[model samples]
Target: MSGLVLIEPTELYNILNQNTIYPCLSDTNFLLLLDARNKLEYDESHVITAKRARCDGEENFAIPYDAELECKTHVIIYDGNCRSLREKCRALQCANRMATDGSKNPVKILRGGYEDFSAMYPFLRTQKIIYLPQELDAISTYPCEILPSILYIGSKEQATSKAIHKDLKVQAHLNLTKSDDVFFDSAESEKYLQIAIDDDREADFGSHISKIINFIAKNREKLRTILVWSDQGISRSAAACIAYLMSYYKWPLKDAWRHVKSCKHTVRPNRGLVMQLSQYEESRLGSKVTNVDDPYY
Candidate 1:
């Protein structure tokens, strides 16, 4: 694995997003996404700009000898599992050959392959459920588990769905929406709290932060899971989660945000919320904390 580079789904997503804003960037530093899955699976659903490359049998996979592809600054390939050393070797050999032929394109494999990538972005799957919410439809397209069984961040629909609650066995919920839709029932083992707040930059979550953090602390010993959600699961709820992490774990704003985004890549807290969280951090630490300016992609 000396020359092999592994790219995470979040990194790939960032690259694609950056390319969209700067079209010329792609022309100069192109990324060629190769799907190493069989033709059938590739045809059904693949990454947005992925092209199929056969990795087994008669014609082993090879990078196309095209000026555009050869000139790409980075190339990424993903199989169903990407666990085969032999396949990796073959792919690397092809890349070496291309380099020898003066292409010099660096080749890498997607970490965890297509499965992990699709898990991170379920909407990319051709046969995936589209969880649409009333507000923030664009942002609420996908819900993600941010902390395995312990915590989840998702859309309002996911928060309100009884089936989803049962499936995930979420024993507790912290709702950040103004709606009265109840998803969790009161049980000895379960708890629910809803903070009626709008998703505005100036929305004040000052009063609710301590309560939410206390709820999580109380449930920690019982092994109860909590789901935090807002209209789109992007801004208000995400900000709350960041604040909880900072308070409970003594984490700085940027570190807590990075931890959350590692699991829920789409979590984006608004600037006002970021300011509030930074203030919370400063108050907690009795010192000024660095503010994070960029939103999570």
Candidate 2:
């Protein structure tokens, strides 16, 4: 269990859409996404940029040519509906081989496998076998999955995308933008909520934290997914999403911020929002533990 790592589909998605961190090789070679399913199943459809994991005649995993297992920053393996590593499933077999191959990081098994990943993010499914560096760089952007199918955070551009709404099964839209224009149309009236604010330090989210958290809670009760977005999907929406996590999960500001940031790498609530969240945590926990002015924030 210590050697095996289970990565959610959303975490893999975020990794794919961004560049590798301090890679010894190109992004394509640095990140190895392996499909552990059979050939026919893989040929029909697989996650974009994923390679088929093949075993040799001696019953050992065959390392793909030019793919440096020792140098690759990430090696993620997946199969159909592989929910656990305890199973003798192909995903587990493939992952076990790589985890011991001295890779740079722990070999990641896509939790719930292709069935769950394709269901959650259908747009990422592709029949393409290979990708050029430029093509990988140009991959379409979407909302960050903050809590699996429950909550997402993104930019105003993603908020307005119908394709994103349909593929991700987005049921609610929370706007943290200063735009006067509406994101959802008339038919989606019940699915929309807006919190108009600039990204300045003066903007206050404290007044609307309750409303935002409640809206997310109500939608989650209905088993619906909500997408929270702002101008860049980096600041205001990040703050509100973190705020919601604090109230719903009763986690301290530090934990809440870390969780959200792990899901979306670009999340950085402005200094003002950090102060507000620290205060919110203090009010709930009876003491402030997080330093708002800390550069680590």
Candidate 3:
């Protein structure tokens, strides 16, 4: 297997949430999360299921010999602030050495490390943890919320759930997938809009996005919450949210994407969709806008 030198925290989070059950690669055995911070830091706050390791002392960089490590398919090492040049180089060297030692397991360093991960998923932290309230549990069903208006990006299931709709008092629903799986009726208090689009590079979303933006803008004053959903709650819905932010708020594509991702860590628009958003930004700004690449993606 190929080794990955850097891994995104969102990717790691998804991997940990999978329900696969292989003999030698069960969920627990599938990953080895190593904390490259000091013992005190590890005790105070570390990634779930992560073991402490050192990268500063004489006997610092020894991989643990636990059974989980032996059977792990991937090894992820992370420090407190992985953005620093010194920490990045150290993590890279450790991952490279693991790869060179004839270990077929993919070894990776977490990008931006614990700092970024904690920012994205505050509930995972041991100290000053933010728990989701009962009312906001529906929002937690999806990866994250994209806006302060209780405007959320979620899966098709979440969009269709009547309980979630009632709990959040959702006023509007936008479905981006090409399916007739709508749950609410127009006669009801809620408004529903669906644009049948496939998640493909060639799928044109120009006019559809414009309509969706208009829909959101039109309902902005009257609605308390609007939910946008696709199949997996990752690609199409995220793209739509970004487009809405750019159109309604006059934000550049990069700034809008950053803001959305700050609220929803796993929102990754596909490359083609991102390119289209970049174009949309240029059109609105009347000039070419520089695309800021998401390093995590």
Candidate 4:
């Protein structure tokens, strides 16, 4: 992505004016925007209160410094005339580089700097990133009598249990194997047939999806239903890819989508992207239909 340089607040406003899809407009509307500058500058009455960034000096932390910031789009502002300008610009440039080079969202930088724009426009502080916690409304006192067999698909972000054991009340989890727990004991999880995928490492989704397909076909009759989940709802590309493959196997697009979405325990993968997994038209050979809900959505 090309870099944007705004000379004034109005210039920034004008750009934002046209891009209604951008998230910056709402913050400006509510006066909640933050200036990324020095504490002294902010305390002495700078245009916007400088929100300090968590500085690790590590360029590639699994999580970004501004990851905690509530907004979907961030407008970083600092004094162009100030000595720290170069440093700030360098950091922003690095972040911007990462965004453009990878399959991730681009980070925006404010051009005019904080000194020139802070007092020019009112800030909106209240609006921030907020994710509502999900609650399970329906309770199942006795596990629904479902299929006995399950196929396991492993990804970096989530740990879904095997289908066979899940019906028998087995649980599998992931994302817990972060950098902090490498030395810790994983014996308990090892007891069950658990496959741990490294979140930091990248793998080919095509091969992984093929493996899942082969596994499911091998135990087609034994498994009653397939459950899919991953971190970031629709964001996990691999999970969505797998879901797509499943849909091709005769699963209903909407039904498979809903099955994964409604799973309370399973990590909801990316929601930003559209995934239409085709549903299986006929029931599995040996399975008895317990619930009428289509296995695939």
Best by lDDT: 2
Cα lDDT tens digits, model 4, 99-214, are 44331233444555554454443331112233122211111111111122232222222233233234333232222122222211356332221123333324323234444444
For residues 1-297, what per-residue lDDT tens digits would candidate 3 score against the true structure? 346566666665544433211111134456666777777787888765566765556534765654344466777777776754345455565565555554567777888888888776555455322323332222234334566445777777677777667655677878888766556554543367787788888778766778888777766767658888888777889889989998888988877887777665567777777778777888999875654465543
Output candidate 4 Cα RMSD: 19.9
Identify the superior model by TM-score, candidate 1 or candidate 3.
1
TM-score of each: 0.61, 0.88, 0.52, 0.25
Report how far residue 71 has shifted in candidate 2, in Å. Answer: 3.6
Question: Residue 122: error of model 3 in Å?
Answer: 18
Best of the two (1, 3) by lDDT: 3
Cand. 3 Cα-lDDT: 0.67
lDDT of 4 at 28: 31
> Across residues 1-297, which tens digit of lDDT does each residue of candidate 1 receive?
124566676656544433111222234346666676777787878776566675547545564545365566667667775644345443444444444544455567676778887886654555321222322123212245555457777778778777666656778888888776575543433477778888877788876789888877777668887888898777888887888888878988888888777655567787777777878888889875665655442
Decoy 1 TM-score against native: 0.61
State the C-alpha lDDT per candidate.
0.65, 0.81, 0.67, 0.33
Location of the lowest summed lDDT over 10 successive residues in candidate 3: 17-26
Tens digit of lDDT per residue, candidate 2, span 1-297?
Answer: 227788887888877654223212235455788998888999999998889998866556777777778877778999998888677788888888777766667889998999998987788899999767666666667677888788988887778888888888888888888674354743564677788889988998898898888878888898988999998888999998988888888898889999988877768888888888898999888998777677967
